[model samples]
Target: MPLSEYEQRVLEQMERQLSSDDPKLVNTFQGRASHGLRRWVLVSLGALVGLTVLVLGAATSNPLVGVLGFVVMFVSVVFAFSPPRRGGPTGVVGADGEVRRSSPPARPPRSSGLLQRMEERWDRRRDERGR
Candidate 1:
């Protein structure tokens, strides 16, 4: 549903008035990027808590539990460092202070024998020639 020009102008005027009337609210809406950040932070904290529990269990005469805790901690650390699917660092602050990166372009469900096929077939022919 596209807005008509009149509706757009009215909405813009309303937004301008509201922003002037309540700058704080406008800033909160535009500047906040905490949803994804909060999720990642909570997951990291959960992993840390679980590791602590395993460590306590290990101290209580379960050596296997201790090993599991160590492994979990390692995995958690790796997860913390792992980049997002967009190839940018997760939990990282960019120039705009947001915790997200430019996302990768999504591949189409059906490739139309475009770039990928050319690359793959080029390598296949090279490999066949080498053999």
Candidate 2:
């Protein structure tokens, strides 16, 4: 069933509160591609090219060329699957070139699970009907 206007408004209020409390969490849900997407694409292309080279080398009976192609494919695969590196601190810099560090935001406590939410809603409706 579709939510009523009051429920929609309540949901919007909750979303606004969540965004204000943790902007990073909101950003994560925005569905943007990761920074390493381009790098991954390039690595995949390199691997494909390496595979083609390997096939050609084997057909021509060139052992050295086949080995080189294997090395390229292996390196590309490793680079593509490796975890991204965390470069440096992302802090604001003052005019004097000194980095200004800010404390991380405090995380909110975990929300209730589905069963807990259903129980709470049931109790609320029961209390309302009793009144």
Candidate 3:
């Protein structure tokens, strides 16, 4: 089922918070989040060129040509699968279908919270056990 508008708003708010809190994770997951069509075109072109070269090499029975084609294919495939370059504005598309630009927080978080929370829980358990 489609999310209600309220839920969408909540999700967008959470996304905004996450993006601000951990830009690294946001960047990692969302990539540059722009120029997707261009990226796809480049990948397809690279793969096509690589495949053509491979076929030409096979037809000629040339070891050097074959090796070159193999290298090209390998590199192109790697580039295709690699994450987009980290540049440009970061954005997250909300369920409402609006793109929200999110800038990184001015300062890095002192702690990610999970570790500190776990430590607090551990301390509480230890104290409880002692008592």
TM-score of 2: 0.45
lDDT of 1 at 99: 46
After superposition, the stretches of candidate 3 with alpha carbons farther than 4 Å from their true spots are: 1-19, 24-34, 89-120, 126-131
lDDT of 2 at 4: 100
Residue-level lDDT of model 3, residues 1-131, one tens digit each, is: 99999998898899767755665676576544457778877878888888888889999998788788878878878988887677745665555545568664468557668989799789999999999
lDDT of each: 0.66, 0.73, 0.75
Candidate 3, poorest ten consecutive residues by summed lDDT: 88-97
- Give the C-alpha miss distance for residue 20 in model 1, angstroms: 34
lDDT of 2 by residue, 1-131 (tens): 99999998887777766655555445455434666787788898989988988998999999988988898899999988887554444333333444445467668776578898789889999999999
Per-model TM against the reference? 0.35, 0.45, 0.51
What C-alpha root-mean-square deviation, in Å, does candidate 3 show against the real structure? 6.9
Superposing every Cα of model 1 onto the true structure, what RMSD results?
15.4
Task: Provide the clashing-pair count of each candidate structure.
Answer: 0, 0, 0
- Whole-model alpha-carbon lDDT for candidate 2: 0.73
Q: For candidate 1, give the lDDT.
A: 0.66
Evaluated with TM-score, which candidate comes out highest?
3
Backbone clashes in model 1, listed as residue pairs: none
**Residue clash pairs of candidate 3:** none
